[model samples]
Target: MRHRPATYLEAEEVRAILARPNPATVEGGRDYALLLFLYNTGARVSEAADLCWSDLQLTAPRLVCLHGKGRKDRLLPLWRDTVAALHRLRMNAQPDRQPHVFLNRRGEALSRDGIAYILRRHVQGATQALPTLDRKRITPHVLRHSCAVALLQSGTDITVIRDYLGHASIATTGRYLSTNLQTKRDALETFWQHAGIRPVRAKAWKPTPNLLAFLDSL
Candidate 1:
């Protein structure tokens, strides 16, 4: 079966969702960091859940190494805001030998379900400000899709997105091309300008005399 187009948030909607998390409180701090990390790296919930401090290079040129499916590992650069949120979260984190970066209230590694719950809670709050959020079902994976579409809209190369998302084939990442209408509109505008096609309606067609005679004969 063919895959459905990805469901993703617009950049403004993503901002509204990110704004829902309060970073002043402990749980809020972790939630903020987790959400930012998800958007920044486009990491699968499993990858984020399995993330370890050792996998992070949070200093200058911050990066995270994601261990993806099939034992494939990829490094992704961390945005400054993401790094700052994570740094604050780390400072407030309790001392533990547990290797996971994101933990539950019990100080255990966060599960995929836990991540989904966090996203749902914040998205619910975000919907108050941005009603569009309520129309679409937002999941942790949807955040991943949002990240991919956001990157595509910014004119990032598709091959790079495929690598960034850790897809085995570029075909998987190409789906974003069809999902992003802004990119399509921009492409159409560019084509019209380059091809010298005016944005005017075509005149209605009328049958020629020879064509009418041929039809009457028939």
Candidate 2:
């Protein structure tokens, strides 16, 4: 049996989800930053949960080293907004620092469930505003799929997305290629453009011989 196609948030849904925080909440910044980081990095929930401060390199060329399945490591570049979010979530002035980049309210490392809860809360809040979000279950895999789909839609080469997602095989990354509507639209548009152009050809001409006379002579 064929499996369902992967689902991803549209660019607008991403914007609405990130617009969740209000000033009254102390943890608002932290929560917003965490979700943005998750979406931007396309890191797995476990990968994000296991992320330590030591794994980040937020310099001129901001990037993160995500430890994905099979203990394999892959590096991905970060957007400026994501880098800024991590910057805003700077560690507390406490003497002993929490090893993880993201932490619970109690200053402990964030678990996968903790991160998922945060994502769910934000997605739920956005649901009232965007009813479309209600129809789907937004999980970490969905966020990961969103990342790949976003890159594909933006015209990033497939091989690059494969490396970015750290897939064991290029075929796994190729799932995005098979189902992207934008890709099909682009292909169809190109076909239409080519079809509109007619090739140079010889002009139509009347027959040189007289058909009735030729037949009678034969």
Model 2 lDDT tens row, 72-187: 77666666667777777764413256778778889888888898888889899998899999988897667776665555555555555555666643233546634432343343
lDDT of 1 by residue, 1-218 (tens): 33344576666677788888899998999998998888777788999999988888889756787899888776666766778998998896654577788999988999999999999999999999989999898888887776665555555555566667776422325465334323433432332232211233323334344433322221
Backbone atom clashes (below 3 Å) for every candidate: 0, 0
Worst 10 residues of 1 by lDDT: 191-200
Predicted candidate 1, C-alpha RMSD: 14.1
Worst 10 residues of 2 by lDDT: 191-200
Each prediction's TM-score against the native? 0.75, 0.72
TM-score attained by model 2: 0.72
lDDT, model 2 = 0.63
Off by over 4 Å in 2: 23-26, 91-96, 168-218
User: At residue 190, what lDDT does model 2 achieve?
Assistant: 34
